[model samples]
Target: MGLYHFAKSLVYGLLKPVYRMEVIGTENFPKDGGVLLCSNHIDNLDPPMVGITAPRTIHFMAKEELFEVPVLGKILPNINAFPVKRGMSDREALRKGLKVLKEGNVLGLFPEGTRSKSGELGKGMAGAGFFALRSDAYVVPCAIIGPYKAFTKLKVVYGQPIDMGPIRERKASAEETTELIMAEIGKLIEVHR
Candidate 1:
């Protein structure tokens, strides 16, 4: 196993029982090629929860602040996570995300940009759509619910890959494309709930 997979499995083995985690529709994940795992943000747990359960290694873009921590700084990149500046158009970060996709690796993105304080889905940022458009990669909508506390059931639902052909052909606005992605994510959340 790769370092990323090994780390995910080890962490997952420990946390699975604590959260009573269940992963649904993992079959929906494409077996190959570049794809985007667009999901809603809830807390710091969301990334690891989805990453460990995903069938493939997922490269994520975490907030730059998290990388400032001494230990996390060294660990996050080792696990395929890179830093991105939140609330701004960080070109370098976007370039990195595109590079991952171009290399035919899975890229995980929390379309909402940051964790939801209310634990409810928030509006998506344009990054997911932008990457999908530029890379011509399939977009998979994933929903992670519950897991708000210890002993609670944490469910992750992987929805079917969203076809962005029409949107890409028409050259849709980033806002419009993001709404569609968020809509798909919302549907997955409702299904898992």
Candidate 2:
């Protein structure tokens, strides 16, 4: 926990001024337990931007390419960020995410898979759904209002965690589960937009 705060302060100290972040709905964020912080991607800095806003430590899953860098590879892991293979069925990524949740840490995910080109939100993929089912972690839906630009008011609105009661009771199929998760995330994002 100390490491997390130290790393967060280091990052925020260096970048917060350059971004001039304006956070909202921070009161809605839970302060404990395993949580899934889902957000829309706008730029490479999106993960750090979203993660830093959480009062608790929030680790994010980034692309495997980031790990290839010499200095960053060493440092990113220390800050609780790791890489994932793109265009592959990354069970390893999913497992890592589940592990993070099971460890009672926050797992930050960009369900859109990549950054938004038109600065418009994309339909969320099933990665979030898989993580939810595997670990029983609550999904805390988030939205970033102005990440395309820099040093501006980029709002992060956190919606209430989802309820999977009926879906689990119904024994929802994978597709059903994925769609359900996607819909809930979409609805949350829409609320703040």
Candidate 3:
């Protein structure tokens, strides 16, 4: 926990002023315990934006390519970030997410996997929902409303936490649960456009 905060302070101090961030619904973030945060992907800055906004460490499932890089790899893992293969099942990534929750760290996921080229949120892959179910982590739907214009003021609106117990307990198919997860995220982000 000490290492987590140390890294967060270092990174966030440098980036927050540079981005000139504006975060909304910060009150929606939990102060203690583990959580699964699901958000739309837009900018590469998205993860750190979410990190500085939260009072806790938010570990993202990063791309394997990031690890191959020299500096980001070292800094990212220290901040609790791990890599996932681009197109495969990526069970190792999922297992790491499960471990994150087990160890009481906040896990961040972008259902779309990669950033959208169209400047819009694409159909979510639903793997995020399955992980939430498996870990029994409370899903917090988030919307990153426009750093489409980068140095400008951006809005990150987070909504109330979604209860996953009923669907998870029902042992529903991955498809059904994914729909619910996406639908809930859509609702929270409805006004972003």
All candidates: TM-score: 0.96, 0.87, 0.88
Ten residues in sequence with the least summed lDDT for candidate 1: 146-155
Local lDDT at 131 for model 2 = 76
Runs in model 3 lying further than 4 Å from the true structure:
1-3, 18-20, 148-151
Pairs in clash, predicted candidate 3: none
Error of 3 at 153 (Å): 2.1
Report clash pairs, candidate 1.
none
Candidate 2 stretches greater than 4 Å from native: 1-3, 148-151, 174-178
Instruction: For candidate 2, write residues 1-193 as lDDT tens digits.
Output: 5766787787788777777676777777777778887787777777767767876678888889888899988887888887888777788887888899998888998888898898777766778777776676777777777754656666766777778667666766655666666566567667666
Collision count for each candidate, in order: 0, 1, 0
lDDT of 3 by residue, 62-178 (tens): 889999898877877877889999778888888888898877778998888889876576888767777777885667888887754636777777877887878878888766776
Please identify model 1 stretches exceeding 4 Å from their true place: none
> What TM-score does model 2 achieve against the real structure?
0.87
In terms of TM-score, which candidate is stronger, 2 or 3? Answer: 3
Q: List the RMSD of every prediction in angstroms.
A: 1.0, 2.2, 2.1
State the TM-score for model 1: 0.96
